[model samples]
Target: MVIYVFDGSFEGFLTAIYESYYNKEKPDKIVAMDDYVENLIDRPIFIETDEIKSDKVYAGIKNKISTNALKKVYHVFLSEVMEAPTVIYHYLRLGFKIGNKVDLNLMDDWVLRMDKINQQVASEKHRMLGLLRFQLVENDLYYAPLAPDHNIIALMANHFAQRMSDQKWMIHDTKRCIAVVYDLKEWIITPIDLPAPPVGKEEYLYQQLWKEYYQSIAIKERRNPRLQKRCMPVRYWSFLTEKK
Candidate 1:
């Protein structure tokens, strides 16, 4: 088995795809550098991220395939699922050959898998848009913490940025150890390691009021855990102010 290993980056993955086509030899597996181990039975090839190679591959996808196909490739990458690179490589192979028509080929296994990954990322992004609860800190920043299954902070950041353009906010993804911080103008993604800090007095008061409002609005006769779980997954309850 031939395995291609890269730096666990989207660009690096694209470079690996470029290598396979350039060498005219397809790899049995495509994995991140840290996930690879030297195996006597398997031939391993390490691929470094090349901007030029990635750019060429990206340009080809945009030119040969639809730009929407390019976006699906990126959304699937953000999914961070098992064998994502291998799946993306196969998906791209089909996309390049069939052009935009590849999207309609749901019967194709690679296309189906890529679609599922993209949908998973999209679902997480949509859920976070409503579930994210922010606390006002001393710095006048709205701080929210989440631990989503997929890497979706980038997807969620733009929506919040446009809706709350006048305010500074930080959305930290604990699962990825990354945060998107917006400074009332632009946003930056960075590594953050601080624990949840104390909220301002007014923030605390507002949270209490919100919790009370939730309690006052709920009717014991109409409570349905199953329906509630269907609308809002139980996993997200921990991040909600009223559920805390």
Candidate 2:
């Protein structure tokens, strides 16, 4: 089996797809450089991410397929599933063949699989929008932490940027060490290594008040742990102030 290694970036993954088509050889596996353990019996081909190649692939997808198709590809990339790259490779191959009708091919195995993965990422993005909680930290920065299963911090950037257009805030995805920071006007994604600043005393008091209000509004006689878990999964409770 032949393995193609990339830089573990979406651009690099695109470049790998471009290389496969340019070289006219499909690889058995596509892996990131860091994750590959050498296998003496398998042929390993290292692929450097080429901007020109990646751009061509990006442009080709946009030109040959509908813009919505390109969005699906991006959503699938954000899924962070182990087989995402391979799945994307197959999906793109079918896309190039059927043009914009690729998504309409629901009966095709690759299209069906890609659709499910895209839904998973989209669902998580929507959930995060409602579930995210922020606290005012030192320096007046609104800070929120998340541990989403997928790399979706970037996907939520635009929504928050518009919603909090005049505020300076940062949403950190602790699972991936990435943060989407909006400085009132624009947003950017960056690796976050800064220590969590102390919360202001006033902010702590507000949090306590919110929790108290949540408890006070609840009907103890109607409490249902299973129903609550079904509505809002227990995994997300750690980041919620009232649940904490």
Candidate 3:
């Protein structure tokens, strides 16, 4: 069986799709170079990323398929799931064959899987918008740190950039060691490794007050641990001021 390997990039993945069609090869699997493991049986072919080819495939998806399908494909990539490359490949293959109605065929395994992954990425982005809590750090910068299940820092950054347009802020995805930083005008996503910056004295006092207020407003008699855990997973408590 032929196995296609590509650089761990969206462009590279799309290039792989382009190569598969041009070369007339039906690869059993399409995986990132970093994720590929040598197996004695399968033949691995490494496809170089070509912007021209990738762009053509990208435009074809947008023009031939629905724009919403193009969006779901991108969100599936951001999921970082090991099976994503192969899944996206098959999903697109079907998309090209049936046009926009590919998404309506939920009975198809690839379509269903892609839809589920897109939903997961969207859910995390939405939840993070409400749950992220920022603290004032040095230089009057607002810093919030989180470890989300998906690579959604860029998506969240756009939301905050519009809402807090006048404020300088950084949202660090500690798990990924990357951050989306906004300097009041524009925002960027970059690789970074940093210890959690200390909150300013006033910010610390505010946090304490917020935590106390959280407790005061809660009625112990109506407390439901299971429900609370479901709504706010325990994994996120470390960065939540009130939970702390």
Top lDDT prediction, candidate number = 3
Against the correct fold, how does model 1 do in TM-score?
0.96
lDDT for predicted candidate 1 compared with the true structure: 0.90
Cα lDDT listed for each candidate:
0.90, 0.88, 0.92
Q: CA shift at 104, candidate 3, in angstroms?
A: 0.7
- List TM-score per model, in order: 0.96, 0.94, 0.97
Q: What is the lDDT of residue 107 in candidate 3?
A: 96
Clashing pairs in model 3? none
The worst-scoring run of ten residues by lDDT in candidate 1 lies at 22-31
Of the two candidates 1 and 2, the one with more favorable TM-score, higher being better, is: 1
Per-residue CA lDDT of model 3 for 135-171, tens digit only, reads 9999999999999989899888889999999989999
What is the lDDT for 155 in model 3?
A: 83
**Candidate number that wins on TM-score, 2 or 3:** 3
In candidate 3 the C-alpha lDDT for residue 103 amounts to 89
